[model samples]
Target: MELKPLKGQHHVSAITANAKENYRFYTKVLGMRLVKKTVNQDDTSVYHLFYADERGNPGTDLTFFEIPNAGRTHKGTNSISTTSLRVPSDEALNYWVKRLEAEGVEHDGVSTESGRGSLAFRDFEGQRLMLVSDELNKGVEGGKPWEKSPVPEEYAIRGLGPVHLTVAKRENTEKILTDLMGYRRKGSYSTKIGEKQFDVNILETGEGGTGAEVHIIERPDLPIERPGRGSVHHVAYRVESEEELKKWVELLNELRIPSSGFVERYYFRSLYFREANGILFELATDGPGFEGDEDFDHLGEKLALPPYFENQRDQIEARLKPLETKE
Candidate 1:
């Protein structure tokens, strides 16, 4: 069966030790809107919080799964090392440099990465992140910033940009990206990690842009990452609908790739599988989004559950510590 190209990133889910702190940092400090305050569907013991642009658009979401007792991440290879968020312009990145400093967040001030201006930083848990300026971008337009964000709309994060993946065997991941997932080899750029310089390959899919690209850095010297708070859980790419997602499932099955099959995520359907390097990849639909259960004006104010979990709401609520998400 012929398959359609996957759109840019749908969301990048990370691990956070404290949901309360995560909410405060992303919503207050970064000025991202808390679009959904839900729980990890597979494991309802903890919270699954989502932060994004005003409307919780497809390519904008940066979500977290809370693990109260999680330890700090042991950073190494074979990991989704860095996630980039899009800003409107190079000027916006300059604004962020001051804002982050004033807010007491340390960052590597504005510098060019892969021909685009970028600022690198980490959350309290040391979750690697970057703000890439979209001033020179040409494809896959960004989402609107939240009008109510603490940061000015122009400088607010617009959406997710290229996700950086570090692996031991570049060929294994490259084959899956190009031959299996249909991503094209855009180009490569030189980057330095500590004292050593390495070439990072750029891969892009549908309507290529910062939003539709992935940067792969091969590091055979490092060990497999020991995941904990601030570590990325998985990276999901966009699919149009359940119909297209089912087709992907069929394609994966035909090629004998093991996957989670189809998972109804309430907001969207998903199919999960790991590539050759053991990094988790999820293909998620973009429709029936976060607005369905909550009002546009008051998203993430209350604990939201999918219809299937409605019956267990009482038990679930009792298990979770109250998180004040209201503005």
Candidate 2:
């Protein structure tokens, strides 16, 4: 059975070595608002920071797990090799080009990819990043901007965009993308990474852009990637309701894909499973959002705890790092 095309991205979770440096590059450099301050749920010793548009909108969320001095990411198969943010137009991308260069950020000059304007760059810790100019899907990002950012809200990244996935093989993953998940075949393009050539097949969500793209590439000769800092931990897809999430769980079971059935993550419910290429994919609910515990105006100001961790708040607080916002 076919599942509904996901609403779009809920969040992209990655790892960073320095909490302070990660906070700086994402907010001060990238100009995203630090919307959430919390600890890793599984291991509360480290910080889980969320950077998004002013409102902490669903598709706009970019989160990090701070693991200081961790080894850099090793590139290979079954990994999200690149995360692209969409800006509205070529002029908006030009704005970023100047900003990155002015800030001494390393970037390749503006170029075109998948038939759209793109600017590629790396964060301080070598996380691959890109800014794509999407005229067709420009205005999809929801919410306002954090007024403090030096970046004019016009050129600020609207939200996450095409995630580039590398797999050792393609057919099974393509089935998962097209059959079970509700992505349509957008098209295919070829590019070279280093000396190796790759074919990227574009897949679009039902809602299309504004964090709705996945570019799947099969790199047959490469070994599997070893995850570390500067690597994407998982990409969470958006679902509208509990029923839709449960439907996805049933579909995964029917397809013989192992899934963690409807796990509660407090702010949003989740079900996790690996795609054929071994990249972890999460189905996350849209309701009971980030504003659940705090008021919209003051979300993520405090170290919010889950119900289980409430009693241990003081201890947990001491164990976690001293994380603060850009403001």
Candidate 3:
């Protein structure tokens, strides 16, 4: 049976040791909007914070799961190594270079990647990230920048760009991406570490472009990553609706790929699975989004819980550290 292709990225979930600091950095320094403040459904003791462009669009979201006692990440291979955020143009990349410097954020000066300008940087907890210029993009359009962001609208981050995956066994992960997920190999680029150089293969799915691409770096020499604070938990790709997600669940079952079937995330429905390299991947629906329970102008202003967790609000609140998200 033929299945519809997966859309671009839905979101990237990462770990954070401190939700308050994560909130301040992404919202105040990076100028993205905090669209949802909730608890991780699987682990209610920690906070699940969603930051994105104005409306918390599927491909724009970069969320964090707070684990106060989490240790620092020991980075290596078999991981979602770096995530890129989209900005308007080459000029916007220049603006970020200066802004990051002024804000005392750690960043490498602007450079070119895959024929486009990119600035590599790290968050307070050392989470790897990049800001890629969308000046040459021709595929999946970016999201609307928040009008009230501290950064100017033109220079504010618009959405997620290509996500980077570092794995020890490229063929295994490549098979899952190509054969199972329907991603096509677009091309390859060279990356260097010390004196060693490696070819990073590029893959893209529906509406191929920066927003829909994935760069896989194979490093058989490195060890598997030990995830902690600032490490990516998983990367989710977009599925049009709950119906599409259900179909994906069935397809995974037919293929004998184990998955967490049909999870209702309130904002979206999802199915989680691990590919051959043990990297977690989630296929998620696009809607019934952030505005469902809050006014459009007041999203993330308070702790928002899914219907099933609403009854435990008092207990949840008592366990969480108060995070001020109001404008």
The superposed Cα distance between candidate 1 and the true structure at residue 141, in angstroms, equals: 0.8
Please state every model's RMSD to the true fold in angstroms: 0.6, 1.9, 0.7
Per-residue CA lDDT of model 3 for 143-252, tens digit only, reads: 99889999999898999999999999999999999998999999999977679989999999999888999999999899899999989999999998888888898999
Error of 3 at 11 (Å): 0.1
Per-model TM against the reference: 0.99, 0.94, 0.99
Ranking by lDDT: 1, 3, 2
- Residue lDDT tens for model 1, 32-126: 99999999999999999999999899999999999999998999988999999999999999999999999889798888899999999988999
lDDT of 2 by residue, 21-69 (tens): 8888988889887777888887888889888887677787889999886
Comparing candidate 2 with candidate 3, which one achieves the higher lDDT?
3
Candidate achieving the largest lDDT: 1
Evaluate model 2: give its TM-score: 0.94
Per-residue error for 179 in candidate 2, Å, reads 1.4
Q: Model 1 — which ten-residue stretch has the worst lDDT?
A: 103-112
Model 2 worst lDDT window (10 residues): 136-145
lDDT values, one for every candidate? 0.95, 0.82, 0.94
